[model samples]
Target: MSAALSVINLAVLARRLHDTSLLPALTPVSVGTLVYPAPTSTVEINPNWEVLYWNTSVYGVVDNSVILECGTTLPDLYIWSFTQPGTEAIKAVVYNLGRGPKIQKIAKTLGQLTIVLKSADVSIEKLLLAANGLFTCQAFYNIDEDPKVHYYYVHLTVRVPVSKPNLLMTGTPVEGSKLWMHCSVDNGTGPIKYIWKHETQNENITNLNESNSVIYVDDVKRNYTGWYHCVVSNAVNTESSDKVWLDIKFGPDDPQIDVSPKTTSEWGYTILETQNVSLLCQAMSNPPSQYLWFYNNFQINIGPKLTITRILRNGTGNYSCSAQNSYLNTSSSRTISLTVYFGPDNPQIDVSSNTVMDRIYTAVEPENGYVALETQGVSLLCQAQSNPPGHFIWFFNNSQVHTGSQLTIPKIHRNQSGNYTCSAQNTYLNSSSSRTIHLTVYCECHLQQY
Candidate 1:
């Protein structure tokens, strides 16, 4: 028989023997025994073999202990004869439900019989069934004998389990700022699914389905600054890591200036003598900054404000200051002008006081009514007045006669002088004048009193 027909026949026999109930009218009764039917096979194997069977057609009837004969007629078989009377051996062949045929045997002799199969072309189920069943033997003659075949089958199943997920963070969090996290597993075969959770009061969070293990938080708040982790899972298992913290940083604001000697006037001024002037520059900032002073366009080498001691005329000019920090720089102030005053110097005069005389005559002849006589010096006095007076000069006959303002004659002689002129001058002004006089000298009258 073929392997396919044997398997089909076995299956039919099992269903009829195990599944069919004989009495359909039987009902359950109180205080009576119950009957249960046996289970039918979903699959089966057939052709049970017995231990004492042999090919009667191929070998002459020896006793039950006879070994099968080998001849030119059975080219594929080997037979060995034994002396023991009751010993017997049988070999059975079966076909695999999946591949080829297999042989199995049982021996009842003290001696051994080795049966070698042509090839290992049989399925595992067929070999197992042949080994499990009782042995039987049959004989076939001629090349047309139906090929002996048997059949067998098998079934398989599998199982899997659920797991917990885990998450990881890639970078640190910025203070009061956003954070980013990544999800992964310790040991799993995966394309894992990722999820994120915030353990806040609201428990508001989201799930992302991407192959990448990172998640981002935008526009983070103070409350959002908390323990954060991730969940990574697959069809097989899931896991999570420990929570992490985050931190963020910020900065300072702009600055301003305030002038001491509180003056609301856009420009500040002070009446300083030959003394030092101090200016205070103040501003608002996170950290105090350095102060720089500027005069006109040039930067001042001094402190926040420029100080000039014995402030002279040159020390006065435009002034300004600047304040600077790491973040920002700013300038504030106005230009100021200074003035100085003084007194006048000593004064002087150019004038003189001296004696000088001239003579004048009415006529040159003595008969002219007593001969009136007039006399004058050659030069006259010239005087000038001042706090510290200057020098003066006198002129006679339209010529300078004295280095000073005055000219003098000892006696009024007849030939003493003619015209006298003088001039006075100083830093303030100048003046000039001229005078004429005549003089007479008479001898003692010698008439002898006649």
Candidate 2:
């Protein structure tokens, strides 16, 4: 008995136990041996497994590899199986008999397969499109009689990258016709989403399609003509197709007429008489446009530009350009008024009503002519006919006196009795006309016997 007790004490010391009892109580030890004093180590963590490690979702691409984890539990046996996208049957792919990985023919058919026994992870290599579905990983730690079996489910999706897209169309779009545009892809996985983009307009036109893969226009307008492209996208990747051109055939638009040597006026354009001018017509049309020029409602010239060597008073009226598209049988016209500023024609200088005109001389005395005037509040008047009206300048004896149409003398003196000149100027035309009149301011003492 003593020897048996000594053997029991030695057995307890070997186990590093401090209990004095010969047969002490021992807590049940877990199946696998702990690597360290604590528990937190496994295989390398893939960022893709952040959701799949605890749950049952996994995403993978075709001809690629995936890792299916079975938590942190260490198992003695592992069996990998799979269920296709639309099946309820579970088929075994590979298994590990606590020895090493042995891949089955089913696994080889799907792709290359590996079972990592150390970390309880199933690695699928060279994934195939047919391998997309739910996968089940069954792990066992103890004997089969009362086995602690763990079941881990992973939902796997195999995807194919999106290929370049294509658009099916024939010729240029015509106005007032049925317009149909179709966007197609060679192959892709999952629910493919299509987005249509107008490069020139910088807008998304996918909303224009009810199915989101086609574009429709009942009556295409000019604004719809531009470069267009389609983007095909799925859960795996996205790709954009090459751009295509959509030309909408229309008619000549309203013509825009512009003139050279043009001056801006409140009403229209202003030009000096005898000045060279050119009128240009601009219009947008499919087959170009024929231009016709009109002056005062009279057709005068044809072509895109009309040249006038010397603009005259007769040409100073409403000028118009008519653009006609022969192909579409449509025409547009625009008009602009041109003002030709000619001159301060002929200016005449005259004395005020209070001034007396000799019987021989007229009221408006000619230059170097005589006018009878004294201290009778004599004033000079300058009259002229001009296109923008005329500004008059007064000069006495060729010296500048005032700058108005009327020059008044409050008191007439002999010094003021020199040749008074009035200059009428057309500032716009830069032309001037002048008339000089001689005034004789004599005292009544010298004026005898009328």
Q: Write the per-residue lDDT of candidate 1 for residues 388-433, one digit (tens) a residue.
A: 2445555545677576645654334444333444444443223223
- Candidate 1, superposed: residue stretches over 4 Å from native: 1-166, 175-180, 199-203, 206-211, 216-224, 236-240, 249-450
In candidate 2, what are the lDDT values of residues 117-213, reduced to their tens digit? 5677878788888777666565555433333435576667788888889987654576666687788888889599988777555554532344487
Rate residue 294 of model 1 by lDDT. Answer: 69
Error of 2 at 3 (Å): 56
Task: Point out the worst 10-residue segment of candidate 1 by lDDT.
Answer: 150-159
TM-score of 2: 0.54
TM-scores for every predicted model: 0.22, 0.54
| lDDT for 91 (candidate 1) | 25
Checking candidate 2 for backbone clashes, the offending pairs are none
* TM-score leader: 2
